[model samples]
Target: MSRTVTLALVDSAGTPLGALPSFGVPEPWWQEVGSIVDGARRRYGVEVSVLRLLTADRAAPPGGCVSYLAEVGAPPRVPLAPVTVDLAPQPRRAPWAQPGGPARSLAWAKRELDRLGRPVTGVNQQRSWNLSAIWRLDGPQGSAWLKQVPAFFRHEAAVLRWLATATPDLAPTLLAADDTGRILLDHIPGDDRYAADQAERAAIAADQHTVQRRAIGDADALVAAGVPDLRGPTLARWIRDRLAGHDTSVVADLLADLDARMDRVRACGLPDTLVHGDLHPGNVRGDGRSRTIIDWGDAFVGHPAFDILELTEGLDEIDTAPLVAAWAARWRAERPDSDPERAVDLLRPVAALRLAAVYAMFLANIEPSEHPYHRDDVPACLERAAGLA
Candidate 1:
């Protein structure tokens, strides 16, 4: 599907300058504002940064004629009369979308880089949404990333902090961080492993298994560092609480045996450890010689099997046998008595429920305009879990 965009332009000083003519963009995702900003610069000679989505004509999110409030660097080089548009600041805006929020983040990043002696030569917004806002900063040294998350995800930096000490090469290097969720990270130099071959994926899974194995004794330390403790009983309790009052038949079926199912998963004897929480090939970055996993905002302390299932999520057509076998073999070697394969089998529905709960948590915390990005995720995950059952 194609997408068209309109920018409700505001000068850097926050003066409203009306709306620009609608233009088409190749990207359909509404939250991916990189293309929108690039399009404005290329077509209208206006360097702009999208603050928040204003309005959309799509029946659902991620497409159609989407309008956004953007902050321009300066007056456009080529001026033209445009339709009047409201550019009032929004209430209850996300931290990154609020007035001067982006500027403040950029300023902090610049200072942090200067202190490190890596002066930033360029800045580009890679993504922006309620969950997180990412910007790529380039310098003579190399590229680095500046990321800011919401209050609910304030633990991301802590997770990375622990990982940086525990397995430095396994994740991006955390350079600087603050309590308010802003972090500066040294860039992982490689391409996203979205198309990694089965053997490569298997090897990656094995490497992550090593991390989880090492973390088993440090689960409490991880939780103390702000990682959510989602062990079997805790996860079951949270899912039960979240599913309460849901009226769907599938949800009802899920609730009926949720506890019993969780017990079976625990009976597999696999100990709870650090989970990637949202593992997938796309989250892995690498060249042929080395690999790095990125995006730990979803990291939590949970069953390792969750990562196994997550690694192959949505790649139904690809053969995942090798990856699963490799992951399970690692667990078996570590804990010979544990039924790693059984844990994978029994946790299928539980994994889906965890995903649904995760989406529910995200929707509860984000603003209404950003809800469309994940509104259907809870129900979709519920339906998927029911099918797995």
Candidate 2:
């Protein structure tokens, strides 16, 4: 006998999109929904679709409530009547509420939205309260993207606001921000791209460098004013620190080589700049004509070379040399007196450090235990950083 599990997708109005059915008899069938859909599509030649459903575990306010059901599953073969439940109307908590309630964030977003005269539309409770809402008005001042900010999300919003103000022509316009860090900004249309061609890639890198150079001056002033530096330690120090805990002879030899290269890196001495912190192709947007950077959570004060490193991560090694050369040429053109060769040399370690740090962060947060890339690539990154030393 065939066994199946059913799921539903409901919107903010509590309306059901449809019921999804999965054919399986496993402990956690919900987790394998994607695989099941793919298998079904391949085996039966049927198009499968999935929708995000928001259902609360307990009747409570939107913020404090949990999305007991928000997943992708197989659509039911037969239509079923929509089921409605009389859920209690409790005070909504901010979606970003953790083990301890962050009531301040809720008050902040609400107050700001009220000032803008807009209602919260769609919200994703996972990975913090990520709300994508719209505020509509008449004329040119119509439509804004409202986002709720948890403590961790403040950096991203701050970076976006900074870019919007400093490089208005290059970034989205900020409408308003509140004490709780909730933000309302002008929305730009276009999807982030992963695969960019040579010229287009060079152009985006140029724009990023321009913004970094401009922001760095301000960042240095912030440092001078006694603001604690958020940029992490230098690439050399980071490699040594990670190596202290690592257990591998290959890594040890690589670290020795990296130690020797420290002088070379110091001699290069690339100037500090306001780095985007994460500048991979995935975070970059636009056709060769114009580019937009999304997700600025990693913004920090660091070497411009470090930003280049982040951009080239996961790409094949064969492409690194030419890309680095192109980037250095652009940097020199912008700052005519600067030595492009020295800057390019500095990028090697900067790249290593950024890659290692990011891989460590990803292993800590995103990857599963059985993922081989985490087990292997992370150590490989450390070794590469050591080699750069």
Whose lDDT is greatest here? 1
Candidate 2 residue lDDT tens string, 1-389: 22243334333333444443434433231222343344434544433322222343323222222222222233334553364422332233333322112233434544555666665553222122222212222224344554544343456556666676778666766667655546666556565678876665666677887787677668865445332244433555654554454444655654555545545554554566677776787777665466787656556666677667666666676776677787787777776666757755645655665556555544443323112224466667767766765
lDDT (Cα atoms) of all candidates against the true structure: 0.83, 0.51
Stretches of candidate 1 above 4 Å error? 12-15, 75-92, 244-248
Number of colliding residue pairs in model 2: 8
Please report, as a residue range, the 10-residue window in candidate 2 with the lowest summed lDDT: 124-133
For candidate 1, report its TM-score.
Answer: 0.94
lDDT of 1 by residue, 27-115 (tens): 88777878887888888888777887777886567678988878776767666456565545445467777656788899999999999
Q: Residue 168 lDDT in model 1?
A: 84
lDDT of 1: 0.83
